[model samples]
Target chain A: MTAVSIDSAPKTAARRRERLASGRTYISAALIFIWCLIPFYWMIVTAFRDVGYTFDSTPFFTHVTWDNFNTVFSESLGNHFGRNLLNSLFVAGVTTVVALLFGVFAAYALSRLEFRFKFLVLGFVLGASMFPGVALVTPLFQLFTNIGWYGTYQALIIPNISFVLPLTVYTLTSFFREMPWELEESARIDGCTQGQAFRKVIMPLAAPAVFTTAILAFIASWNEFLIASQLSNDQTKTVTVAIAYFAGAQAHQEPYTAVMAAGTVVTIPLVILVLIFQRKIVAGLTAGAVK
Target chain B: MSTLAQPKRAPETPSPKTKKVQKEVGQDRAATSQGRWAFWLISPALVLLAVVIVYPVVNAIIMAFQKDQGLDPVTKVFVQGGPAGFDNFVHWLAQQCGSAACAPGTLGAQFWSAVGTTFFFTVVTVVLETVLGFWMAVIMARTFRGRSALRAAVLVPWAIPTAVTAKLWFFIFAFDGIANKLFGTAILWTGSEWPARWAIIISDVWKTTPFMALLILAGLQIIPAEVYEAAKVDGASAWQRFTQITLPLVKPALMVAVLFRVLDALRMYDLPAIMTQGSNGTTTLSILVVDQIRQGFNSAAALSTITFLIIFLVAFIFVRFLGANAVASATPKTTKGQEK
Candidate 1:
């Protein structure tokens, strides 16, 4: 009886400790969730709040209205929210398409083909990825001005492609290298040419990887602001630049509510997309970071 | 009959061997052709890179040496100035105009302070993110219910645009915002000096800690569960297991994450640009470069070149001295005998 009591006492203690550790984990998890999300919650709450109640002290929802979102869309208020969204879509779309188009072929070669200077090419891509946008701003500004290409979609798309291409190539190369080449070999044995084998067997298998790369590249291009801010004219300004320069109804007011609405408008779609593709996005991100 | 069968079998064996050689020769030829295809495949990206990245970098360096096309103070007229040897560099590095030190509020005068501010933000933000992210990663890495939900929640901040992040935090730091209410003191968050810097740090930490956590979580997942079980069997405490096993194993991912965060914090512009407009001593090197560009293009070029050199130097140090293994991790491990 004494032995049983002693053993049971320690076991209960261990169980209690386990329960306490789990409780702590949940508490910290809750804290982290709030810490990450409070800013977003504030943004959304303010976005829906009436313009006059921008400073409403209540932490919870109050004076909810759509007026702020309306103000964001109202052009007479000097807010180009709609036009800016369209511009963002156009630039990011074209950039993604072009980067993927070039990136897929380059990645395939880097992964599947036996080539000289392969690592050199990979190194170049990595280096370009790390090149500072500020460094390129002045020269690209001047060059675009000289070529009469400033404020053009091509101006934004071209530079964005250069930036996003490295990410696309790197991610896709790793994905391709992991693919089974035996299928391609069998296709070749069955009388398919190299290109045919790539198209029929390899590309179909590569679709998921391509999709992941596209999402990342698109998001990156969409969020680009540095060179965009310098190179874009009023007509071609992106949503980010538009939000940065968001104006008030009158000259002196802050336009806080309307800006929040604009921020919400731009962010909600991305947030939803990320939540949906969370796994794939995480895979793409960590693919280059870990072996 | 035995002799005849032996001769026939010997010929059959050599035929199979000869076929294998022929196949190898064919593969070698296909490899060369594929190499040529690779050259063509990559040239388009290489050319675009040259035009967009390479040429511009070269142009920036050249522009850094050339004088700005502006009024000569004595002449008081616009002059497309000719080459100026180290004048642009000296203007920034020495904080001088001609010979004397630049007066306060001049673009040149802010150079060193911007450098300092950049380094300050880099160090503070990277360190905070690494610590917070590691903790977050440890929690997320544990086998718990709602783990996926936690991960998805964490990604929200990372997915939001940097510009939007700046604006979101801007509203939070407003004079009559929730931050003031929560703290119960009306400290001017974005208006004052230290508060403004801290505001940037807090928002930056919030935005990027998820990235660090995610990277570290990937590292943590790769650590075999057997390792912990074995350590447990040896009576290792949680702290001992974490430091001795988890920390060392996660170091590579941690280093890479920190390297990226440091480089990113160094070039921080959008946050400060929108939040405070680089007022009250928050101008980073990128902001300084952008501000200088508005006044003098050549000087901005010089400043940006300097910024480039600094970032490049940091990357070199991280890759060379630190055990980040950035390039090796980025590339695939299997390179030989796998391709047809």
Candidate 2:
């Protein structure tokens, strides 16, 4: 029994040492995870805390309530948060759909066709997206005004589509290029016409890329504050813009908690999207630089 | 081979009644039709881009040369008059340099300060983000427990909207908020010059470092495990293996990511505008351009052109010197058909 105990003691010590090393790794990992997450946690805790308690020294949930969320949704100063939500939905939705529709066509050609100046076309689209968007605001603002589109939904939708189309095209083109030749050829051999082959064979294959591009484009348009701020009025303001301009229901109050609640509302959808489509988001994000 | 290419037969020659020739003809027809289909498929996007993006950009460039007429009596909006012959450019430069004693409210002082602020923010944020992001990427690339959850933690900040991020940090940097509480000092992060600048920079870093890490992680993933294994077997230390094998392979992706972040940082607006309202010495080029829109289109156009040229030049250098497209195309190749 003494020999067996002696043998196991050192083994246990070795095991303990290994555990300590791994525990150190876990500690560092936990630090990074906490560093990344604290702001989000604070955002939620402040979002749920009673309004007056937001400025407290301790950054903990003491007086938790749903009052801030209720205030964000309820009417205040003639700016309806619910209406802003719908406006954001409409703008982001229309922008995503239109960009996808146009982008798919361009992406398909860019990927599969051996056209003249193919590289030039790709380069041009990429360069357009990189053009400082704010630089265009001067001209776009002027043009929108001349056409009487200022404070209108089209004002936001048009520019958002223009800016986001290049991203969609780039991502989807990369995806489409990776599609194997055999898939399309087989569809052709099955007596399907080119259009039918596209509809039946290519469309299904393209769906995930399309979905990824859509989410990306949607988030971009949804998160857009510059153009929306410049173009939209109270009636047509997007959630991002509205939240930026959020004021207290009563005078002289900062409406800090309500703003946090609004921020949470806007952020929840994106967080859920990143969680659900984490792989696709990573793939789409690193599409240009990683491969 | 029979299906891909058609055999060309002279009309004068005797008809070759073979299966191969028939298939070749089918292939020829298919090839021509495919090209036509491609053209049709691409035209809509090209047309839309031409009208929406290309046209306005050209118009803006042209408008830069013109003079701004104050509000049109009939239209009540500013109007573009005849060409000003570099008047706007001269006026813009003059504002920045002509008189050292110019009023703080003058456009020139504001312009130069904004230039300085933008440069500072870009350099500091890009440097910090690259270093921090590279570190995070190294951690992410390591095989570990709960790696995915850690990746998600990093991504959470990135997934949230920039405006929300700005607001989140704005509260944190408030005089009576968490930053002060944690540090045991009241820094007035958004109400002072350097403190406000740091606030903007820190918030930007927090939001975008994940993006940098994600890109770098992609670069790291493409480096094969066998290379490191071989290096270790050869008695190379971890540091040596990393410097020799990993750094060289990841350089292209790193350069592309940095250039992308640089371009993005130059156009930064949402964060600073939200965090400090461009007060406290945080007005960037974007904020200046937007601010000048109310004054006149001509000056703003000239400013816009300058900004565009700067961005274009940076992109040109990246593409020409570093071969950004080469590295860009590399990422997709590694990921090919994996999504399927």
> For each candidate, C-alpha RMSD in Å?
5.1, 5.6
* Local accuracy of candidate 1 as per-residue lDDT tens digits, A1-291: 122455787889977999999999999999988988888998999999988889887778899999888899998987788899999999999999999999999998888776777767887887788778899888888788889999999888888877899889888887787778788877876888879999999999999899999999999999988878999998899999998889978688789998999999999999999999999899888776766
Compare the candidates by lDDT and give the number of the best one.
Answer: 1
How would you encode candidate 2's per-residue C-alpha lDDT over A240-285 as one tens digit per residue?
A: 8888888767777668788999999989989998998998998888
TM-score of each: 0.93, 0.89
The fraction of reference A/B contacts recovered in model 1 reads: 0.68
Each model's fraction of native contacts: 0.68, 0.64
lDDT of 1 by residue, B131-221 (tens): 9999999999887788888999999999899999998888888888878887888888999899999999998999999999999999899
Q: Residues B1-340, candidate 2: write the lDDT tens digits.
A: 2124223432335456755566566666766776677689888888887777888788888888897887643467766578777867765666632224345776645777787888889999999999999988988887679989998888899888899999999989988888998889978889889999999999999999999999999999999888887887788987898899988999878888888898899899999988888998999988888888888887788888877877778777877777665324632333332322
Please give me the DockQ of candidate 1 compared with the native complex. 0.54
The interface root-mean-square deviations, each candidate in sequence, come to 5.2, 4.2
Docking category for candidate 2?
acceptable
